[model samples]
Target chain A: MGLLVVFGQIYDPAINAAALAFDRALRADLPDGVIETVPTFRSVLVRFDPLEISCPRLEGHLQELLARQDWLQAEPDDAAQHWVLPCVYGGARGPDLGKVADLMGRREDQVVAAHAAVELRVAMLGFSPGLAYLGQLPEAWNLARRSTLTPEVPAGSVLVAVRQTVLPATPIPTGWHAIGQTPFRAFVPAHRRPFLLAPGDRLRFEPVAEPCYAAFDQADFLRKSGG
Target chain B: MSGLEILSIAANATIQDAGRPGFLRYGLSAGGAVDPYALAEGQALLGNAPDDAALEFAGAGGRFLARSDVWLATSGAEMTLTVNGDARPWRQSFGLRAGDELRLGPPQTGVYAYLHVAGGFQTEQVLGSRSTHLRAGLGTVPRPGIVLPFRADLPHSQQPLKLPRPGSFSRRCFRVLPAPQADLFSAETRQRFLAQEFRIGQMRDRMGMRLEVEGSAAFQAETGLSIASDATNLGDVQITGDGTPVVLLVERGSAGGYPRLVTVISADLAALAQVPSGELIRFQEISRDDAVVELRKYRREINTLKDLVQPVFRDPHQISGLSGMNLIGGVIRGDEEDNHDDD
Candidate 1:
């Protein structure tokens, strides 16, 4: 059985901070039968082995941990890793760039500038393997996902919607608008550490021309922790 | 140095083991053989480690040429097997010499089948497992001209053995426990779900399977259908916007927003996986204690399969697809007579 600890009704950085802190604490001093913990936008899902521990008992233990802190006001973890990756925006690489710019009532270059202006936090890794959802973009950037899916988006495609940015390591169908393409590889199964960015890791994108982005050795860039 | 060379293969054939758990936080699901009971039975027959990797074939298996003398065991979804162009019985261990061709045909009843080698397949481990997660691009799919390696140094003196085939392939009634959002579904809706005989839909895969309920009135939650996307569990029966019920499987996503009405218990998931598309199925509500007790009993049953392995008493008629081969005494003679009649 799994226990979900939800902090709020909607997405909030403060709630995410509390959830991440709680996740770390639980992992550091795990309860018996606690298989794993997954932190998301405003909640943490603690999966436990039902055979080893009953749901009520696990719930009581989590209640005690929840009462230990005012997680809503807790500061974000300082140990979170930061990365700045090179991205190519508004071209054939990202077919929906023009559409997204038009929706925002801004030029393509302005959209790119606005996207690269802010640092985002990796709220969660989900939907697909190594797909990170980085979020809390300014309210002005909040946009709805496409009514129909784009059918397929290549790996390293940077997607934005609902005040969040998503980076996929493999081809997938998405409702989000493809704003740019990144040279960095977010997931490499052959590497010792397959997933490059953890849930709480912070990241920023540096806009680069298509020609310069093509010269990068993706594996090498990932090894250097983003060049 | 011992291995098997793929002569021809169908799509979706790959190496799998018990699966990689504890990685769901990274958006990766535990992707193992859909029919894990079959995997266990084959491993028991060959005396391999519990987590030893084996070939998981979806629908149909392929033709393989043994690169060296090796013992092989087949289990799950009774399929047609032929060694060196001679019909062989499924669910039994047999030996193949260097350059012997082993062919596997389409399954007769179930959707998944397992093939086991003496020492297990020596494939490179990714994230502590050999199970292929196709959505994650974690492992390579077995294709023609690829060589699956295994340990040749191990002793190969074990006798040919067979176990009773799994009975779960035909199972239609699966027991389910309440999911986190079960309360959102009213008593009437829950009762309707139990009363309904749902047919498996055509859109099925490792990720999830959609169940087709009768008529346009699918089970609807009076309290709306959308929930904040939270971590999802395997076997979760999630209700989509159109009121369709989808049971998430081994390769399910880590998180989803749909309201989950119930979750099938772990003990019956393997059985549910074998139930082919277009088949009728029903769900039975089970309490938490009952589900735990059932799971324990299922694990014990699987653990004791090794004791049930017995020497194969040749019964060509009892086995399907054996009509083409010549029938002799209880024992059959072939070019490799000594190895074929181990008893």
Candidate 2:
């Protein structure tokens, strides 16, 4: 563990922008001894080898980087891409779609429309390989994760909770509502580029019929979809 | 084809190396050997490369049959080694002829043991490494009857190397540095943590080891224990909501929300991994400067492992019924000696 440069207390676009900007700057001109820099929701975790630099020295270096610019107003990376993934909502594909609608006091179709309506930013990627935590869902859609775990959610699962949507690349247990399923895999180790999304990348889901989901070449989904 | 066929193996025994790093951004933890020191030791003994793959046996070893002539080395947790029903030195390298059965027993002192080949195991690499990441499904546990392939072309003219067993398993106290959320716990609670002696719990794996303390007065944080999800590093001591401390390891989740109180330094992680369950342990705080110095020393130690290795000269008098022994079939040829050190 090295040090954290906190940008804000809660999840905000500007705060995350600052964190991502700082992360980008750090990665661009990484200081000596720095092992890795992870950009989370509201902070950038700069893990460094203490053998190369002390914590105090690393902190001071980070402070110098922080003072170079007003990170709060930094623009998102220009290379950040916008993705639209085809998804199958409700029924067997989304076991918790009805549950989420019930909690939101809306019909299942309405819930689907509301969820697919807003584009979210990839605020963080963690917990499991290639699992992206997309953020800033409509305030009306803000919900809590389930009290009980859903034993296991498969890859491409669309999970929603606390104004964030999670897309897991592997089967994992979750507390969030699985409202949709996408064929697009965010993580493919065999691919030339394993990770499909990066921090600050924006994406929105496009509802497709279950049959249409099967038509999207599974093997070529990485190249075919996310257009 | 040179290969080691698995006759039988303990549960969770899998292939490992230095592990895959640089994937934390994609939520992948650097899953690798639990005791990297032992892996390096085996490599030194066998004259293998640093990233050579070896079988990491936890708690117990297993039975393997060589399909062809292959030089092998054993390291990590001390375990009884028997080649074709004859006992051999635990930390010595030896040759196994085709059909020779090499059996390893349960560890006598630590959790993980290693079996290395003269040439690294030629397993397929996933994401630039051959280390098994069970949780992430990168590799699978080797099962019985599976053949593990390796390169055995080079003739090892030098005598098999013999290295003394490391005393890391006996270490009880380890060095630690405060984690990012160390201040979340009150100073009094932190002091109590330093003063307390905990035992390794039965719940242990590549991911982490749980520490069990005496009595009901658990270490509590003055602030909220659950922080926003953030990247977790190796050796991080994460305190769960119920007040239990688990030392995250190589195969740990990339990110977690639990408050981390401290992190064991890299140099001491191998020793910490060797401490058996029920072993009592205490953590002492060390400054970043000191930890860095220790790491440099550790790197130097690993680099000079070849210096510690000595030739295991076979004694003619010690060989029982030398005339009746099938020396040519079992032993390596002496004339093939290539004096060049592979390291």
Top-TM-score candidate index: 2
- Residue-level lDDT of model 2, residues B259-335, one tens digit each, is 88999999999899899999899999998778888888998898999899977766555664532434432223222
lDDT by residue for model 1 over B44-110, one digit each (tens)? 9898998899998878789999998777899988889988788888888777768889999998888
**Highest lDDT model number:** 2
lDDT of candidate model 2 versus the reference: 0.85
What ranges in model 2 sit over 4 Å off?
A53-57, A218-227, B156-158, B321-343
Relative to the true structure, how large is the alpha-carbon lDDT of every model?
0.83, 0.85
Model 2 chain B is weakest, by summed lDDT over 10 consecutive residues, at: B327-336
> What interface RMSD does each of the candidate structures achieve?
1.6, 1.6
The 10-residue segment of model 2 chain A with minimum total lDDT is: A218-227
Segments of candidate 1 deviating more than 4 angstroms:
A217-227, B223-226, B315-343
TM-score of chain A of 2: 0.93
Candidate that would win on DockQ: 2
Instruction: Give the Cα error of residue A210 in candidate 2, in Å.
Output: 1.1
Model 2, residue A222: distance off in Å is 4.1
For candidate 1, list the clashing residue pairs, or say none: none
